[model samples]
Target: MPANNPPDQPPTPGQEPDRTIAYRQHNDQPYPQGYPQQGAYQQQGQPGYPQQGAGGYQQDGYQQQNYGQQVQPGYQQQGYGQQQNYGQQAYGQQAGYQAGHQQPGYPQQNYGQQPSWQQGSDFLGTGQPTAPPAKKGRKGWLFAVIAALVVALVGGGGAFAVNLLSGGGTQPHDVLPGDALGYVRLDLDPAANQKLALFSIAQKFTVTKSSFTGDDPRKALFDLLKKDGAGLDKVDYAADIEPWLGQRVGLAVLSPAKTGGEPGFVLAVQVTDETKAKAGIDKLMDGDKYGIAFRDDYALLTANQDQADQAVKAAPLSQNTNFSDDLNALGETGVLSFWVDAGRVASFAPELAAQNSEALAQIKNVRVAGALRFDGDYVELAGVTRGAQNLDMGQPEASKIGALPASTAAAVSFSGLGDIIGKQWAQILKSADQSGAGVQQFATQAEQTYGLKLPDDLTTLLGKNLTLALDSNGLDGDQPKFGARITTDPAKAQEVVGKIEKFLAASGTAAPQLAKVPGDGTFVLASSQEYAAELAKDGGLGDDESFKLAIPDADNATFAAYVDLDKLEKFYLQNLQGEDKANAQVLRAVGISGTQSGPDASFSLRLLFN
Candidate 1:
């Protein structure tokens, strides 16, 4: 036996501490001096803590048991019923205190259940209990919103990557002759992302979307071809063309066999199935006018069998060094591309050769290439002319049109006009009049009638930089405000103005007003004096947001142009109605810019969208 007679004191040697006494002490309630007697403890199912009885421990709403008896069905026992046992009973469980099962009228809870005092119970003073605060509702909508954002970001990023990296398909140069004089290719089947973009952009307007009834752009084009005089009325697209037709088609103008013979052409069409393509061509063409021959993945169509055979036998355009180099300089080849061998073309055409022999001889090695590309917000047509040195246009200089007013509706600026006119006047006149006598007579007549030097006065008037601008404010009235500002010597410009005034007076026509812009070495010729003064003011057009968006590289452009479609829409679209007017409104502006570098020159024309 162990000694434990004291109240609220530690147990004696070898004696177990009573959990009932510990629980009561934890709640700041006094423990009995000795073992509790039967019926002396609190009544069963009371709100306060459990107490030890003489026969067994009991709590409110719990069954009584003798010390040596087994636990009742409504209660669980770990130590009290059998001898010398002392472990905690599971709380908030059904019947015998097992996990995940609840007792009668008791809320279900995990093993780490809090004591009654901390579980919203008034057992410390009022002897009553309350339910735990209701749990908060789950925030499912927040998670859903997060998931949607994640998907959008991932999907958008993937699409952007595909648009930049995807290659549409085989190009036309893959099959054309290496030494062809010129080539034009149309790519109906582009990359997946490009096709999707084209479809989406087209669908934005009511007019364009009407033709694109389905997702297949190629089918729509074939349907259109069948309706027009495309000569495909007898053929069925689903059964005849779609069976073997590929995505790309190219037309090449071959050089003449000798200098005087006429140039021939070869049409190369991409084909997936050669047998079907051959059969389709037989049905579509007459033997006397057209011929077909297959090489690699393309079917070559020509005027005759011999030309078709020869085109296939020749080296492909992909292998031509000059053609490849020029195309590579042009960057991405888009839905449409064209290449011209200037030297070969000039050599083949007798009329062009006779008219400008000197110019043609100098451009014997030059080539010109261009492409058209589409984007989500804009469409761009870009071109490049290689070997520009052979036909020297003039040194490129940046245009100074950015000083025009922000209200400018349209403007075109050019540099090096004087140099081109001064150096090429004689050659130009010779080309226009091979006999040379007619041009001489015209010059003499002009000089005699106007009393001014011919080319000298013209070159001085044009100067280095010339810009023509139309202001939006002028469009409100019958006579629109417009002017041309030219960079030149003020005194010389005034002299030219005087000569023009005299000529206008002699002809009995009204003379236009011309004056120098204050502080700047430029002259403005306008419809009226007030408009000329407005043109002289610093308007900061270059710094305007719309102008910058339209002409991104205006600072480096030798030649540049801008037109505000929004400002001009009222004049051009006033008569349009319904879908046509709405579709036409999609265009916001157009910008053109060009640059020249030694033997290479490039230009870009872009149409911006709303």
Candidate 2:
């Protein structure tokens, strides 16, 4: 609990005592006392007001002295029959104490002398009705009002403190968050062409988040406010959510806590704001709304493939299976799939599955493939492509008016200009290529293994010597042998297969030996991927380099992940250390599958460390 400051003045009677809640909480299970029990005190039927005080009960015009009256200005006395048990005989005996008084008519007292005490139309002949006593006058009334206000403040404030300490809970009768204080705090991560640029923002933000209610809503509200941005080592949300403090929302209140001395309510609510959310993601990727511009291959691919309605993706089975599933390489669209606990993911209603229809449309064919465990009520999706090779671009590289360099092409939008990168985009020409360059990358190498060749020239690129496994026999198969075709240096592989060709070249040789894990059947690479992969092999990547390289900063949440490797082996030993990292530092050493092509994928870097 936070420390307390002293009150400006001493507490009054019946006020909530300081620190009462904390003390009471120490004995949380003590029985509650003094609830307004059901049917405690109510008029049995119609209300009635008989003549004066008890003994003076007038019975149809009979009057007498103050006979047997309990004399008093401020005291009450009990009667006989009330104390006696009622048997027929006991009832008769009790009746005898009543003193059946026959009142002889006595004239009422004359009020001329003490006229001030006498009730009159004209008070004390002052021509005005008698006013309240001076002690109960305006000054007295002022004192009363001030006293009342103080009581109320103490009650309200103290109750608020108590409620906070007790977990300001909603009661069965309170309005829900969507109904009371309404707003939302949306987070966004836009799509980069490939790889994802991590992003988040702290700009002022707002949404109609509501809450449920029951007890003292003020106390409940105060309690909730205290927790609004209370996070440690996480991005602070205070500046972003403080502004939407007073808005009222409409929603249902679900569960509330039991009521006692505290006051307040808890409310769960839904919120919405598409634009701010998108911008916040921009913050995470960059600082300002539009602070930086870059590319994200993972984002573009996922969005594109999903829009295209492709559904080949998969996520990890669980944490126990995380590394293996990642290396499995089942993702077809170049999508990198992994597991996130669906049961733990929580968010507001405004950020519903229905919000990103247009973005979702971009990847019409995209699918979130995974064992049922990794999926939630819903998950955003995106596509991926390993290199330009197995992609689905419809035109030839020189289709555009002018040529573009690889780094230069990264900046230019192909949407406005056609694929003029010429040989620059030869990889795109090959995915659905009828010349079967895609299949040839594998078969030609195979034919070479049998002592044949004379096809296209393949060389000229730098790449990291990293991959999960080697085999074209689909997901489940033994590692293929290079059989003595190539060397083991990854840098060597990248330097050789960097160029593209339209005419015949090459020869044949025995397959090279395949590399495998120390003990497991897990593989490093084989003769085929060495000959077939199109992405440059030497442009080394840092372990934490931005995978997205074709768009401005953004938060692209959607993905159609693919894991290429031996499901069993990749699940255990392989690792994909990001760019600029040693092959020895693989993210996870495991077996994997190979994609004719890979898809674009995104991930929240924060959770990775977690």
Candidate 3:
């Protein structure tokens, strides 16, 4: 909190942020100021660094920040290259965050790196820092088991599949805070949803907001699940937590235990299934020109249909065929299947087979039970023997939205049951809104509220998503900033597409190039990625060989402003250093340029090149 210094501090002992770059940069991308020199975000006990490791919060005025302890917005796990094997805790547990890298060991057992990494962790796990359980002795006929997928389906009866595409069971969508790649947990018992399940649910439930926002505000998105408005009205807490004033789908899991236990099947699912709730498959207002938004999640399953079908066929069920087409389909009428745990039904449940689905069951045992986020537009139905209460009904939980007329609620659910997860997710976001911190303050407050110590690493992921959402929402831009442009560029467009691959690899936000080209046209990035109009204007445009080829319309800047070295020097000498707040001034005007012609057409594009 020193007045002279910036918020981020230098690296500390053992807490140094990884400064080594494994690969060489072909181009010279300027590092943010004080970047390698180390800013305020260092770990504790590092060489030449100060001993500051509390909350990095200052009391009065002059205190060095403990970068080690400073909760940042995008803290991710660091990985050292591939390790020969799963070593003792020593090599695994480093003091501070390291950039996720592959270790040299683990030739036999695969180790997962954290979420941001793109390469193989050798193991299927991301570098999430989990202590995987030890493998038992190899069992006989393992290959035989692997070879029995299709036949297994015939034997087991449930047409099931495990999809590696759609990012391994995760529906294609903006990567949200909890969207880190992970394993599917299969469990059984009385159905009551939980957070993990709700997250899975959100991944599946897709909605068409007149205008959507966020990495994916699906946390409390299940409020749209209403059969007759009864489900949404079940819990009075939806409106308080959800966003956009939507309805709660009444998605909940009533499991057997009150504490740590495996998540059972989705106990109650009351999603609003509009759009016929199935793959449009050559059927659409646009004539199934690819599935619609609600159907997008299901459509992603196409990438791994073969593998998924094989997996599904291996699951136990009565009769199954849809397995071939809808590799993710798991439902009745002699058709059953198994699916990778991407938020559909949890492991198999054997008891509630007859209930098919609970209808108007009293909320007797409901404690607002935990929630799960379902991803994609797919159905999972397994035929286990049934008892009095049926557990696995994909009814969307009701809470993200509120007060829907029964019919309206059902309409919403049937049409956008997939999107219900979106509504449900909107609610979880409220937990961040408390005390104005919203998610930014979660690291400090979450311990008491959620009862678990969610580290800053995870909080940063959430905060970044929230920040992007808020920025896009224009609550900050309702009036609109005249300086920002809303046009596109071809070369920049290409950059927009490439950035996703880069960002996902490092979880680092890169400026969008397409937004920089000053013009009047729609730039299309990959179908999935979006562009930030403002940042694009700031990136500056380019007219290279590729640019002239793709950009249908291109014109020289009606007004141009190259990097003004003299003006920058004068401004810095005259106003910055002379004033105590020079730090802030330097941050605003450092190494950036802009050009303007029409009131809104011109932009800052030179920075990308020079």
Candidate 4:
């Protein structure tokens, strides 16, 4: 490390340090200064330049700098139509540090032919290089990009709608995180949301001015109604109930039950003052009203009468520690959240329930929760899933999928692979037997068709844990590269490989190459020998910072996955057309993890954006 250089340590969370944008000015016995000091830079007040904020870019007072003998001539008009030129120096030319030194690649300046460029105002010394100006239309392009993001985020009115449904309150006072099978929390109050940098910046472009004027959202609603010729002028939401509006809101996905041929679910919200809330509701219902019920601070607002009734009858999250813990696993709190009760949902949703009864039965006992928060370059979403007693997450074996390489485009690891496959396979055979699709004769038919001895049972051929990963480097090639790592019993490993090879041969496909890595009987199956060799290398995601940040406690998780958002963006840009490619660039990375404790399991996903 050079003495004059700053520390190279990467930033810790919430600790972004200053990044040197310009070379430091030279001082003492010596060489000409490279650039001006902080103080001088602050005085520039350059337009379009970002001002210093609490966390970044503080400007100090200016200090004089020096320029040595390599000084070049100024200005040449390349004409406005071309990339803007800032005089003869080509805008980016600068003298080397040593006396009479000139940086390479720059055309030697001819003093005799030098054109006059603006002087004195240039804080950078005469010979010092100037920062290149932004390209034409760059600012407009950036604004458009940001506007698109804002519109997409605001689209669906879903942000507000979710908050409204879940009781958007500052505290989990009325309904605990566990009150519903799943819930989403969002900061819907315009004032509160604006505090967030994303919202704050977006608001600059958004129309903050309401039609009716003033700060009340009710007034804004009325004004909007009037614009549609609803004649809402007589309504006075402010006088009726604006005082009870809460800053934060939540939306909950309650346990499911069958209702009216549709999967039943309760959507609930929180009310600050029941009396005032009802009055406000009554006012809104003046034209057409839906049933509204209240329990404590929560308000049940759904068109489905039975679902609404069930919401009022069900146990609130306040009483369930499992549900609460699942929510807490996502985050103690967040701007917005979402949840799903796999078991409960499977019971009522006919489509889901119709899956192999065995598979559906296994899935029914799980509960999932997710949350959101604002963090560097990403709008993160965290999720959690819990499982039931009958469900197996391959506990004894657990998952030794280890870490994926940092560059992995996508990865998924799960335990209970054997158990799940075995169960599903059994169910398939049973259904086939009953449907006359094959049953007892299926195994023989499969063997004859594929010309391989098809095992009647699959559990014996696979392991408890499995990991599937893909790298970006592969997708661009003739065949997309992939890695499938499985943890099998050492005794059965050879037989398993043999079976797979035979199966592939029979199917008229190339056999996947494989390599054993150092872990609990773990081996890699890759699309090619090169990929297999690469998989044998170290640096599996185990120690990657991004992986750790996204999915902690991997060993305990029943399932985990990671997606390199940066790579995905690149892939999308290369393969996808239309606006989607542009929109895809916004994400940076995504990670998902799930852990089960007894009958309940929690799952979470973290999404990072650029």
The TM-scores, one per candidate, come to 0.68, 0.17, 0.16, 0.55
Residues 458-552, model 1: lDDT tens digits: 77788888889999986978888898888777678778777778888988997655544533777778877788887876678899766776776
Which numbered prediction scores highest in lDDT against the true structure? 1
Predicted candidate 2 versus true structure: per-residue lDDT over 1-610, tens digit per residue: 1011011222234322222221221222321221111111111121242222112323344221221122343222222111212233221111111212221231222222111112222211212323321233322332333222222222222122112222111111122121211111111110111111110000000000000111233234444555684332232334332222221221121111232222222221212343343343333333332211111111111112331122112211111232123223322111122222211121122232255333233343232222100010111222222222223423311111011111111111111012222232443344436445675466466455533222222211111112221222333345432211121244434323322111123333333443322112111233354323312231221121221221112222221112212222343333322221221121221111111212333222210100
**Candidate 4 per-residue C-alpha lDDT over 210-321 given as tens digits, one digit per residue, 9 for 90 to 100:** 1101123434545667789775555576676565544444566544334425333344555688888777766766757465677656666666566566566766554565
Candidate maximizing TM-score = 1
Tens-place lDDT digits, model 3, residues 1-610: 1101111222233422222111111222332211111222233333442322122212233333332234344432222222211234222322122223222331212223211112222112222213332222222132222122112211111100011001111111111111111112121110111111222222221111011111122232233344345344433333322222211111112232333344322211112343333322222122322211222122212212442343222322111222111221211111111222112222124332233223223211111101111111111121211111222322322111111111110100011222323433433345346336565354445445433333322322221111111111222333321122222234443443353445444545554333233234322221112333433322222323222222212333222222222223443344432222221222111111112221111122211110
* Candidate with the larger lDDT of 1 and 2: 1
How many Å off is the CA of 416 in candidate 3?
A: 52
Candidate 4 structure, TM-score to reference: 0.55
lDDT-sorted candidate list, best first: 1, 4, 3, 2
Candidate 3 wrongly placed segments (more than 4 Å): 1-239, 242-558, 563-567, 570-610
Regions of model 4 farther than 4 Å from truth: 1-245, 248-280, 287-317, 320-330, 338-367, 396-407, 423-428, 431-442, 447-457, 472-480, 489-494, 497-520, 555-558, 568-570, 574-586
Error of 3 at 551 (Å): 17
Model 3 per-residue lDDT at 188: 15
Error of 2 at 543 (Å): 33
Model 2 stretches with alpha carbons more than 4 Å out: 1-422, 425-456, 459-561, 564-610
Model 1 root mean square deviation, Cα atoms: 28.5
Q: Candidate 3 versus the native: TM-score? A: 0.16
